[model samples]
Target: MSEFTVSGRYKNRDGYRAFETTIDAVNEDVAREHVLSQLGSRHGVKRTEIELEEVGE
Candidate 1:
């Protein structure tokens, strides 16, 4: 499995929420998008932008 790190901000009624998460998946892009989308939807956030980083030695 591939590993990835995601960092982003969510904009909602209250304000911006900073978030980060790491996940293991076969494709990094797909995983990052899925996670970011979930965060926005679950939190009642209307807008979001995410950045993905691959961890290495």
Candidate 2:
């Protein structure tokens, strides 16, 4: 299964919390794009304001 997820809170340093479920994928690029698209369009967040980081991980 392919899992794409996000975790973040507004205005909390990184301004969000996000992560993905465990899954295997042939190509990871498209999954990332999908996650980003969902976050921006569905959540009303701009792409520029979102930055992936290694905090909780």
Candidate 3:
């Protein structure tokens, strides 16, 4: 697995909130999905509401 840095923003009750996190994945696509799923499950943010600004190794 490779480490990737993911940055994004999501829609919330208080408005938009930004986030940056790292994840281990085989590739950038999976890393992006992981971030989306994590934010969705953890903060109740939907896929549509989550905006992924960047994903890089």
In order of TM-score, best first, we have 3, 1, 2
Poorest lDDT segment (10 consecutive residues) of candidate 2: 4-13
Measured by TM-score, the strongest candidate is 3
**Candidates, ranked, lDDT:** 3, 1, 2
lDDT of 2 by residue, 13-38 (tens): 55566544333343456555555676
Model 1 lDDT on a 0 to 1 scale: 0.62
Predicted structure 2: clash tally: 9
Write one digit per residue (lDDT tens) for candidate 1, span 30-55. Answer: 77667767786787554434333343
TM-score of 3: 0.97
Model 2 residue pairs with clashes: 6-18, 7-17, 7-18, 7-19, 8-16, 8-17, 8-18, 9-16, 9-17
**lDDT of each structure?**
0.62, 0.51, 0.95
lDDT of 3 at 21: 99
By lDDT, the best candidate is: 3
lDDT tens readout by residue for model 3, 5-53: 9998999999999999999999999999999999999998789999999
**What lDDT is obtained when candidate 2 is compared to the true structure?**
0.51
- Model 3: pairs clashing at backbone N, Cα or C within 3 Å: none
Tell me the deviation in Å of residue 34 in model 2.
0.3
